[model samples]
Target: MIRGIRGATTADRDDEKEILLSTESLLKEMILHNNISAENVASVFISATHDITSVFPAKALRGFEEWKYVPVMCMQELDVPHGLSRCIRVMIHYNTSTHQSDIKHIYMKNAVSLRPDLKK
Candidate 1:
């Protein structure tokens, strides 16, 4: 089976360190909570709001020695009125036996408020 895991985080600025930290934390939590291994991940797509351009969030994962082999891509999110700012979002496509409903999606820090329905 194939399932998707979602993760998001917020940063105060579009700095490299901030983007890397938030993206790393978000990906780590998503994988840990869902008990997914790097080999199980088919691909990862990351996006940042228009306001963020310091660095590509995907690079953080690519630079990680453990996840260097995982396929990752980054893009700029569509700009819309009242859209979330300084946000980095990730979608992981995993080749797992788990059902879609069993997958855990993480929205951390201020980003958690963006999806109150999943806070529990």
Candidate 2:
């Protein structure tokens, strides 16, 4: 079965380094939470709020060879009236045997406020 795992995080600043580090941290958490290995990932979709133009969050994942074949695409989130700034959100699709509700979704830093209903 193909399941989607979601994760989001915010960078302290729009600097490339900050974006990369924050995203890498967020992805790592999601990977750990879901007990996901690179081979299980089908693809990852990343969206960053308009303010985060310094770097592509997907590049952060490429730093590790594990993600080399894990097709990733990064896009800009729509600008909303009160949307959070400098945020990076990811949805990872994986072919897994786990049930949908069993998947762990991660939200960290300032992005946590976006989904107060989820387990942080």
Candidate 3:
């Protein structure tokens, strides 16, 4: 079965370095929490708030050679009133036997406020 894992993290700024680091940090945490391997990931959808224009979060995802075969897409999040800024959100679809309730969704840094229920 295909399961979806969600994760979000806030970047210090729109700078490339900060965005890249923030994205990588979030991905690492999600991978660790969910006990997931890149080979099992079918695709990843990443979106960043409009404030984040320095770089595409998917660029950071590609930093790992393991993602060479993974289908990853990046998009700009709709700017909603009072939405978190400089936030990168990702939904990873993977084939796994784990139940949806067993999937660990990660929310780190200021992005934790976005998903209080999933916050660690």
Candidate 4:
């Protein structure tokens, strides 16, 4: 079986390091909670709001020694009016035995408010 783990984080500022660290933390939580393994990962797609252009969040994940070879991509999120700013979101596609309802989704910092139902 396969499932997707969704997570989101917000940057306190427009700095590249902030974006990278926040995204890394959020993705780490998602992966840990879901027990996702490198071999099971199909791909990871990341998107940042227009206000975040410092760097691609996926690049930070790729730099990690454990995930250096994982397939990941980053893109700009849809610029909808009044949308959240400085936010990085990720969708990890992976093969898993867990059910969708059992999957954990992480939303951190200000992004937590965006998905209150999943906040922990």
Go through the candidates in order and give each one's C-alpha lDDT.
Answer: 0.87, 0.92, 0.91, 0.87
lDDT per residue (tens digit) for residues 35-79 in model 4: 888888888999999998778788778766777777898899999
TM-score of 4: 0.94
Output the lDDT of residue 89, model 2: 96
The number of clashing residue pairs in model 3 is 0
Q: Model 3 residue 2 lDDT?
A: 96
Model 1 stretches with alpha carbons more than 4 Å out: none
Q: Residue-wise lDDT of candidate 1 within 54-115, one digit each (tens)?
A: 88989778766767788898988889899889999999999988877777899987788878
- Point out where model 4 deviates above 4 Å: none
* Best prediction by lDDT: 2
Alpha-carbon shift of residue 117 in model 3 (angstroms):
1.3
The C-alpha TM-scores of every prediction are: 0.94, 0.96, 0.96, 0.94
Model 1 score (lDDT): 0.87
Model 3 residue 85 distance off true place after TM-score fit, in angstroms: 0.7
Off by over 4 Å in 3: none
lDDT of 2 by residue, 31-108 (tens): 998999899889999999999888899999999887898899999999999999898999999989998888889999
Worst ten in a row by lDDT for model 4: 60-69
**Deviation (Å) of 12 in candidate 2:** 0.9
